[model samples]
Target: MADVARIAGVSSQTVSRVSNGFPGVNEETRQRVLSAMKELRYRPNSAARALKRGEFRTIGVITFTLSTTGNVRTLEAIATSAAQEGYAVTLLPVAVPTQDEVRGAFSRLGELAIDAAIVIMEVHLLDEARLSLPPHVKVVVADSDAGDRYTVVDTDQAGGTHDAVNHLLGLGHATVWHLAGPEESYAAQRRTGAWRAALEEAGQVPPPLVRGDWSAESGYHAGLLLAERPDCTAIFAANDQMALGLLRALNERGRKVPEDVSVVGFDDIAESSSFQPPLTTVHQDFAEVGRRCVEGVLHHVRENGLEHGTALVPTKLVVRASTAPPPRKVIPCS
Candidate 1:
């Protein structure tokens, strides 16, 4: 600070105003200070500035697994949005989704220099670990149903699932089968429930649910079972990854997509449109979810009070080559 001020021919207070982006320093003066800073390669002490402002200007992100497409995309968006807001993001991945692991992650993040936290609650562990979070740290949850207890920002899981199922049903399919993700996942549960409700609302009996571990391999196994059922003309997989495996399985079994069997999937991933036949799936606004999460937490931090509610980002149904009217049954000559 002293060196930069001396070089810029200004008092330390003037340099501080320039470094902190405080208005009052003339444009030429600010330019001189910046030039001096650049020459000396001087960077302001963020830690000291944070102390004075009573804020770290950093947000901590805690997530269960980055393996899933949604989590990975949401995390990327959060990082980008935080940077736009002049805040840095610190990521802490919890190996296990247990209460103990979640609590530990919160404790570790509390010890760090973060003004708030955004938790990607793929599972229900947050419900059990809520009380363990630091009182001073504002928190916003994503992809969970505990909105009544904590502020949450998430994709409209049920709405997307409803749209996916209804699209299939609207195609004149008798009934749409579901290939669900892991049972414990909040997203999977919401999607599965929505699928069932959508079918029932159409006066169609819901078919048996096939469970998958959110892996393509699991989807392949589930597909094998559904392929043998001639009545299963249309299917909705919980995610695009599973839908990819289902497509391969159906192809191997000689079931032509949108000809013999139509498929709809959630999470319109990047490769979805490039699938062999292209995928008809629900599109989640991961970037918007991430942006809202950061915005929600920062709002609480600025207000100095934690607010609890749910903010849902809308989803879109992308129709592609994978979905169409079910095959017309051929009748033999009497």
Candidate 2:
């Protein structure tokens, strides 16, 4: 602080005011102080700053896989928002929330000195595990099914699936076959329910559903069965990866997309548009999901108490070349 002030020809108090973001510093003084800071390459100690302000200068975000597109996007959004708010983020990765892992994570978080935490566990059955966090630290659970006891932020998986299937039905398809993710996933369950409901409401029998573990391989296997079925015209895949696999399976079997079978996929992954024929899929705004989660956590942090609320982000259907009207009738075997 003394060195920077000497370099900038300013008082130490002026340097302090500039660094602490006090508004009274003149523009010229602020610029000079910043220039001095850059020349000195002096990095402020966050821990020391926190100690003086009674803050950690950081928040924790805990999630399973950082590699998944959805998870990555959500984390990025959270980090971006936190940075904008002048806070650093500490990322904690846990594979699956077991009782021990949940307990351990919270314990480690306390040692790290974070102001609050956000958990990105998206399964409905993890309600029992959500209670393990320390109550002193504000906690926000994303995609939670823990009732109103915990704050939650989640994309409208069911609503997106409903819109996708409804679009297919409106295109005059007989029925939309579903390729779902692992049965245990909350998103998969919601999507499956919505698909079934849409079919039921439309007076069409819902086609048999094939399960995938959110993997392209599983989707490829499911696609093989779909290709052989003459009644399979429109297919709704749980996510874009599976949809890509389905596309490959259909291509290999000499079935033309939209011409022979229409496909609708979820997540609207980045590569969806680059497929041989662009994919039509559902888009979940993951950044919005992250923002909501941060808001929930911040709310609790300020109040020092859990806020019981469930926020569902909206989803939209992106139409492309992957869907069209079904054939007039199944082509007879030669």
lDDT of 2 by residue, 1-334 (tens): 8999999999988988888889999899899999999999976776787898888867898876675667788899899888877778999898775756776787888789998898877553343534455656688877667547777788988889989999999999888999998776678888999999999999988878888878788889889989998878999999998998899999999889999999999998888999879999999998889888777777676777765777899999999999999888786534
In model 1, what is the error at residue 221, expressed in angstroms? 1.0
Please count the clashing residue pairs in each candidate, in the order shown. Answer: 0, 0
Runs with alpha carbons beyond 4 Å of true place in candidate 2: 2-13, 28-42, 124-132, 303-306, 331-334
> What tens digits encode model 1's per-residue C-alpha lDDT throughout 1-334?
9999999999999999998899998999999999999999999998898889888989999999999998999999999999999999999999977778877898898789788999898876644644345555589989888788888888999999889888888889888999999988899999989998999999988988899988899999999998888888999999999999999999999999989999998999999999989999999989999999988888888887766878899999999999989889922224
Deviation of model 1 at 233, angstroms: 0.3
Best by TM-score: 1
Supply the global lDDT for candidate 2: 0.85
Please list all clashing residue pairs in model 1, or write none if there are none. none
Error of 2 at 244 (Å): 0.4
CA lDDT, every prediction?
A: 0.89, 0.85
Q: Residue 37 deviation, candidate 2, in Å?
A: 4.8
Top candidate, metric lDDT: 1
